[model samples]
Target: MPHRPNTPCRHPGCANLVPYGQQYCETHKLLHPEALRSAGSRGYGSRWQRESKAYLRAHPLCAECARQGKYTKATVVDHIKPHRGDPALFWDRANWQPLCKPCHDKKTWNEDKNPVYSY
Candidate 1:
């Protein structure tokens, strides 16, 4: 079997090369334990894959982009409310919305970094 070429570490400004199938080299990898987690553990197993695909097919346009009058195609099915390991919330289709990659990333960053709580 042919061997795959090593790829650069995904960490920004890091030119270090890592073996194929690995996202970050050893040093940077420690900084992102969440990325190192398995997809199944992150609630992105076969079920989520299937459901998210169907959702994207049904809601092809990004919700955030639509608000801004841009018709971008949604590639991610994001939960409007953070599931936070709650099985019920994770599987709730009503809490889901279609978002493009940029919108999803921005939303995730904001929520993860600066969460708002209703108390």
Candidate 2:
């Protein structure tokens, strides 16, 4: 098979080509680190849990699953974009979507270093 054409990485000053299906090359991704933290960190505190749970309660079906004609029950509320501990993005209702555990895990798999739930 012929090789797929590569695209330039979006990060400034970087000439690396991003692999297919990825936004940034692995090196650039590491350079622009995510604001990751353990569960008990300030950004992942109790208030977030309550708010996320309320979001899920208000929208109790997986958005992705619904697109595929499956009315799966949502167990999690996800950020449409990676918040990376940004309060503005994390709390934005417009950025939130209801997702079943499986859908949530799949959506976040590439964004984060580890899966929220194992398959």
Give the winner by TM-score. 1
lDDT of 1 by residue, 33-86 (tens): 667788799889999999999999999999999999999999999999987667
| Cα lDDT for residue 82, candidate 2 | 72
Kindly report which residue stretches of model 1 are placed more than 4 angstroms away from their true locations once superposed: 1-36, 116-119
Misplaced by over 4 Å in model 2 are 1-36, 113-119
- The estimated TM-scores of all candidates read 0.66, 0.62
Weakest lDDT window of 10 consecutive positions for candidate 2: 110-119
In candidate 2, how many Å is residue 47 off?
0.5
Per-residue lDDT tens digits of candidate 2, residues 1-119? 98778888766666898666566787767654442235657466798888888888889899999999999999988889877657788778899899999999987876555424223
Report clash pairs, candidate 1: none
**CA lDDT, every model vs. true structure:** 0.89, 0.76
